[model samples]
Target chain A: MTSTLKTFMEEQLPIIESHMYEFVEDLTAPTSLKEAMLYSLKAGGKRVRPLFVIAVMEYLNNPTKAGYTVGAAVEMIHTYSLIHDDLPSMDNDDFRRGKPTNHKVFGEAAAILAGDALNTLPFGILARLEDVSAEQKVELIRLLSETAGAEGMVGGQVLDIEGEKRQLTLDELVRVHENKTGAILRFSIEAGAILAGATQEQRNLFVEYAYHIGLAFQIKDDILDIEGTTEELGKTAGKDVASEKSTYPALLTLDGAKEKLAEHATKAHACLEKIPSNSKYLADLTDYIINRNK
Target chain B: MTSTLKTFMEEQLPIIESHMYEFVEDLTAPTSLKEAMLYSLKAGGKRVRPLFVIAVMEYLNNPTKAGYTVGAAVEMIHTYSLIHDDLPSMDNDDFRRGKPTNHKVFGEAAAILAGDALNTLPFGILARLEDVSAEQKVELIRLLSETAGAEGMVGGQVLDIEGEKRQLTLDELVRVHENKTGAILRFSIEAGAILAGATQEQRNLFVEYAYHIGLAFQIKDDILDIEGTTEELGKTAGKDVASEKSTYPALLTLDGAKEKLAEHATKAHACLEKIPSNSKYLADLTDYIINRNK
Candidate 1:
């Protein structure tokens, strides 16, 4: 059953990748500087962020055309964040997604410039959406900007970085993860609904579903870092332990972490129940998140 | 006569700053994060980018409220670039506008995150435009995004960093400046016209005007770096020369540089003639770019 899900995800990956690449290609600046931006973009991630976007959009039965622009926009923002995160002055990582990071290939200055370009390009993509209603598109851009911007992910990142040298309470840890990782994830689900012209109530429910799922998603990764094999989890396992940064397992006992995951997954499922019964795709997504091993 | 123009520009600066601050404040998030975003935004710069946006919008005299939203959006992008530019990994600067840079107050990670936050906030602001047709707002966001994104300014910055390490031919250099510094300057002006609903012909004229003025603005900066005082410039004097970065002075004799400035200024002035005589702002802006001192 898990293999079936992975195969399905694998199929969707190329579709998202193709659309994302098209968007990037269309928007590449007519200059050599674009080399870095393109390098980081094509440098390859799991396309997980974009897959989340496309999955949710499909779950809601929104036409791909309506959500595709903002979907690509979200991926651009995510990719840019990774590029900057791996810079020497930041995480100082040499590799990302099993490959040389953006800064490594492009040089630090060009990498910085490339990330900056990706950051700004999403808005450009959002701005160009024509299939959706103008009002819907505007709202979509607003949601994405907030999700990706300081008040959301960046602020979360700041808090996370600051928390590195200090011990954070459980609430504090949740706050950091919510902003750093959760905001965009929440946006990923809700944006699809917004573009699909989902009702306000429906959008709110989608947000609720995304919230718990986002939190669980982080906790599960913590579990995976401890238990999963190196091959299963690409880069490295137990690296978080080496970093001494807070994690779900660090704060909670193994059983406690498992309980929290169960509770959150249940809540996520409850949110899904509020959706129309026809949302088979979202149902699959909820299961995929809870059951994903790597 | 120049003082009158300077005074008007000065008066416009505060209005621009207040609008920018207020718009940033409107973004909902944790208070601390909001403060982080506002820290650099409120820190003073020339406000040239936002002013370009407003001046162009003022030219069209459009009553649309989206103009103000777009005005704030560009300022955020400009501020973000400055914040990133001041980072240690980039220019390694400590002071901007005679005060500590964003990274000095916030740690590098926080500073990087703050810059990222500011960069994405523009799209959110654009999405929240209260008074424009949704279609108009979408168009505005699209136009601004392209000019600011990798293909435009980011691409240019890449070229700039690379050019620093190697000799660039005059055409290569010009293409770079056009993308890096010139694209946003052009966007600032072009965006104003865009929000004001300038026809294609009007937009074309402004494009011509922006091109010459943008280059003239850079040329003037190169001259000022050599001739201007640190106190007046609000940045380290001769830093450009110290860094051995390419500049107009590096490529041309002082006399040659001056002649080029005069030629660009002349073209900028000629472009202004295409606008109606009643448009005093357009005429004054061309004059302002060429004649102003720090």
Candidate 2:
């Protein structure tokens, strides 16, 4: 299971993205709607969430079709969130991943429908999966829906919208990030654990691992907003500052934010050390999150 | 089973509303987000979809928690669709059911998120149900998502938006309404059938019944748009004509439109007659759909 992380990702990313494209393609759909969905999904994403599922399965020396299906499903949810977040009513961003946003290309109504479709396709995919036990599938679906639903990502979105209007305290910021970013990342890792048949103890470690990386991931994003260039970041740089929105770097200085990022990355790596699996890929991914220019 | 329909509705409507309100209430969260969600769900209206589930369950004499849960879940999806459909990017309606739309009350961003949450919360509710087998739950969820997802309600919505811009052929209009309105109503009746363990044959009849009634329902809506005043309709009247949107009465003469409505209602009744369940309520409900002023 311990292999060159780059080689492993090289082998996995294509399959993951292909699976994603396959799930969304329909025989007689409006061409624009399907195209809008595929454009955002295929925009050269890192495929971190799906890969987390795959890597976790690889780490445990247990793999199943459930891994790929759930992997693609989580990635769909993530992509849909991005699509919606970029709407005129929300962040009003013109670009994502260095390309025009979905609305910019598809028009606002189609973009909204595309986001709705992507957000919705995952559960249907999970429910249609028959290779797994009904109980297991339900467990995975329950966890996914709850984590991605109102009290989680959507709730965090509400808080984020509010935060754009006013400065949030540190505690409020933490709560927001944990719900928005942490919830889905947590679902990504936990879904893999469930499919891998991990014991509660191992699952807890994965939870701890995802928790640290989730925060680290956001903190790095905030840092990148300050330090990274537009080309490097793909999206516009200094967007948080331009919008007058708070970020880790906004509240703490840049150096303080970098330190915060390191602390969480270290904690995440330490948690991975406790798990009895070849989790080095996850370890490498955590580092990659902090070091990524975009 | 054949009690006065109004008497039965009076008894059932409050409980259904309560179930809805209960699913969305979350402590330790932003009061405004929750408030926005509740405001739409609590808006006075005929809880027709949820009531369909309850009535179907009663007709089959197969009452279970799944009925209430699925009823609430579908209603949530219905409400969420209404919210998103009213957004500035979509229909841009100022009022619905005689009150300001969710975006008018909650701001555009919150309204969008509120719709997202409601659309999402249903699958979680289905997944978390313990009374039914996981297989059953999965079936329910798969059906719900598929009917409500891209190829179904959302797909229909894309066509509806397109229809507003140009005239649609009668067949195209039928496709749009079936997808947008027919699918959810189909899911409602079919869900109760699944819960009651109806044979595939009965489910097919329910499908036909839903199809006929769904078209009838839309034709009646078009008729109301032409004949009803703004006060009776609760939203703007003559909207289809104002927008140059095609309708049954537009494609056919007004008398012809009435004949078409009657034709579908007759077909719906014939299908209902074949089902063995105590379906008087469904029959009465179909009559209500075509005759209601609003």
List model 1 lDDT by residue over B1-294, tens digit each: 356557767777777678888876776665666776789888876677776776677667663445556767787887888888888767888998888998888777667777788888887777777766788778777877887777777777666776888767778878888887898888778878877788899899999988999899888988888999999988988988888778888888677888999999999888777775444665676676677677
Stretch of 10 with least lDDT, candidate 1 chain B: B62-71
Instruction: After superposing candidate 2 on the true structure, give the runs of residues whose Cα lies further than 4 Å from its correct spot.
Output: A1-3, B1-3
Q: For model 1, what is the error of residue A97's alpha carbon versus the real structure, in angstroms, after optimal superposition?
A: 2.6
Candidate 1: list runs displaced more than 4 Å: A1-4, A28-32, B1-4, B30-33, B62-67, B277-279
Residue clash pairs of candidate 1: A29-B151
- True-structure lDDT of candidate 1: 0.78
What is the Å distance of residue B294 in model 2 from its true position? Answer: 1.6
- Candidate 1 local lDDT, residue A42: 75
